[model samples]
Target: MRRRRLPATALAVLALVTAGGCASSPPPPPPQTRAGHPERGAQLIAQYGCGSCHTIPGIDRADGLVGPPLTRFGARSYIAGKLPNSDDNLRRWISDPQAVVPGNAMPNLGIDQIDAQDIAAYLYTLD
Candidate 1:
């Protein structure tokens, strides 16, 4: 018996139609909170020089390798691989990393509660 194969272009078209454009979709907006401001948080992240360590998305010149890349921070399950990624926990971790895990790479930036909230807000928008 003889066999025949479909052309590559035809296969590509079939795949695209069957998979619904490969499931590509714009992610939903990050949940909002009254106390935090994402815009302000972006400024704070730059002012605090967080980009020197972590490669944060959206922020300019946020290319760093010391800390983890914050490309999809909103989808993260845990902060510092320890505490839950809730707003409160994230705020605490941002404010004082040493206090959270005792000797973690993220340093104690002396960020106040409000600033931490804002930073968390900005991070959550990355997703």
Candidate 2:
């Protein structure tokens, strides 16, 4: 018996139809948090010099003994040993540590709301 093969163009069309007719990239990851960008948060962390007092896993020069290590900040359940480890509290701590916990070593970095949100988003990614 003799066999016949489909033409290249026909095979290409078949491939497309079999593969859902068109190619598309995957859906983007859901927003990490409301109005928060983890990538930007990382940069902001570095820019604000948070690494100078804490040991962050992904940022360079983030090793410091003054503050507790943040390698697993996402797993933590409290900020400054007082506030709940919720996103809001994290943002509050980042924006005004002194306000959250008076006489604490963590100083107020004057981080804006949006920046604080982004930083919180990044911190949550540690897990």
Candidate 3:
């Protein structure tokens, strides 16, 4: 018994397919802001105990591994690996994690829209 070699054309097609499969999707747009207060957002983060789960920069005792580290969240292109990293998206995610990413480890802290915006504003400053 012996193995048969694939044709040159077959190998070329395979290579193209493999390359396409490995291609990464383009990143989302940069972060946007509207009616947000960074100072309030920072205060809210601590008030809500967000540091207990996320590693927020500039916030003392905000070193946790339960969630992704938010060292440069403002510079990121996406939120939860899907939604664009805009202020609106961040607000929505903060208000209700389940709605943004179902079954996500982040819980819905019952945060209102205003507080969410504040939080997003603070996160944008990390960049």
lDDT of 2 at 29: 34
Error in Å for residue 29 of model 3: 3.1
lDDT of 1 by residue, 95-122 (tens): 8899879977888889999999999989
The candidate scoring highest on lDDT is 3
lDDT of 3 at 45: 97
TM-score of each candidate structure, all chains considered together: 0.73, 0.71, 0.78
The root-mean-square deviation over C-alpha atoms between each candidate and the true structure, in angstroms, is 7.1, 14.1, 5.4
Model 3 lDDT per residue over 1-127, tens place? 9999999999999988777652276566673545689999999999999999999988989998999999988888788887877877888999999998899999988999999999988999988
| Residue pairs with clashing backbones, model 3 | none
Candidate 2 structure, TM-score to reference = 0.71
Which of the two candidates, 2 or 3, achieves a greater lDDT against the reference?
A: 3
Give the candidate order by descending lDDT.
3, 1, 2
Ranking by TM-score: 3, 1, 2
